[model samples]
Target: MTQDELKRLVGQAAADYVKQHVPEGSVIGVGTGSTANCFIDAIAADRARYRGAVSSSEASTERLRGHGIEVFDLNQIDSLPVYVDGADEINALGHMVKGGGGALTREKIVASVAMTFVCVVDASKRVPVLGLFPLPVEVIPMAQASVARALTAMGGTPQARVRADGSPYVTDNGCTILDVRGLQILDPVAFETSVNQIPGVVTVGLFAQRGADLCLMGTTAGVEMTDYRN
Candidate 1:
């Protein structure tokens, strides 16, 4: 199957997982990205089953609204029961390299708030290590250079992420993304904390020790579940 088809299969698996796990009257956390879009589509088809959702990005909020899923700000909700998202890369331990769509900060916030985080992706995204995909770090434009230099010192090649319009890609929170390459990360928690210590660093794409509760990996063999819960 093509990548799109694979993504759809994985997304469907994730949606099914969420539908089975998230109880009625529970507040859900929705993330951004194409795979997450597939989950939203699935959820929308079963609108009456969910209570509401807190979206991680404006784009996701719009889509949720189109599907009749009530969207709320994070502060508006007392607590989130489950947060389902897609990862750019996820390791066996459930650590992920996110923010390919530049919504990492918000996505992380929502995921952190949820009781459980479910990551959905194609099999290609599963890896033994997390840094193969360029790590996305959101930063303030004023400290972009400083942060880039710091990441470089940490053994990464940092590049300012730009838009197809040639402008600096601005995140929903008005931050810039620095795609960092060339680093083989082993200790994700330490790396996350260290990167966040940099001035103007909003949030790095590294989803440290906060492992996913479950992962839905789609492959030619079909959808498979990685249940971290024991």
Candidate 2:
């Protein structure tokens, strides 16, 4: 199957998993990105099953609302049972590199409040370690240079993200992103902690501390489920 097809497959599988595990009328946390968009499309078929959703990005919020799924503010909701999202790269241990679409901070916040996080991805996204994909670091606009220097000191190439027109790419939070390349993350949890401690760093794209509780990985064979919590 094509990559798009694989994404749709896992998307449906995630919707099914949520249907089975999450109780009716419960609010769920939704994430951003292409794969997560597929999940939104699939879950739309059962929109009534969910009370609403707390979205990680404005794009996802618009998509969810487009599907007739009510998008709720995180502050208005007390509990989120399930958070479904996608990853850029995921290791054997289930830690992931996300934020390729520049929604890392909000994604982390929504995922943190959820009882379970279900990551959906294609087989190509699976990796032995977490750093093959450039690690995205969201930084305050004024402190971009300082953060880049700090990241360089840590042995990686930091490039400020840009738009198609060559202007700086600003995130939904009005922060800029520095996509750091050329570092192999052997220890994701430790790497996440250290990067987060960097001044002006809003949040690293490393989803280690609150990584996937379970992953629905799409392969040529079908959707293969891995329970990280187990």
lDDT winner: 2
TM-scores of the models, in the order given: 0.97, 0.99
What's the lDDT of the predicted structure labeled candidate 1? 0.89
Task: Give the Å shift of residue 50 in candidate 2.
Answer: 1.2
lDDT against the true structure, per candidate, is 0.89, 0.96
In candidate 1, the residue pairs with backbone N, CA or C atoms under 3 Å apart (3 or more residues apart, or in different chains) clash, namely: none
In angstroms, give how far residue 136 of model 2 lies from its true place.
Answer: 0.3
State the TM-score for model 1. 0.97
Encode model 2's per-residue lDDT on 125-229: one tens digit a residue. Answer: 999987889999999999999999999999899999999999999999999999999989998999999999999999999999999999999999999999988
Query: In angstroms, how far off is 48's CA in candidate 1?
Result: 1.4
Candidate 1: how many backbone clashes?
0
Question: Model 2 off-target regions past 4 Å?
Answer: none
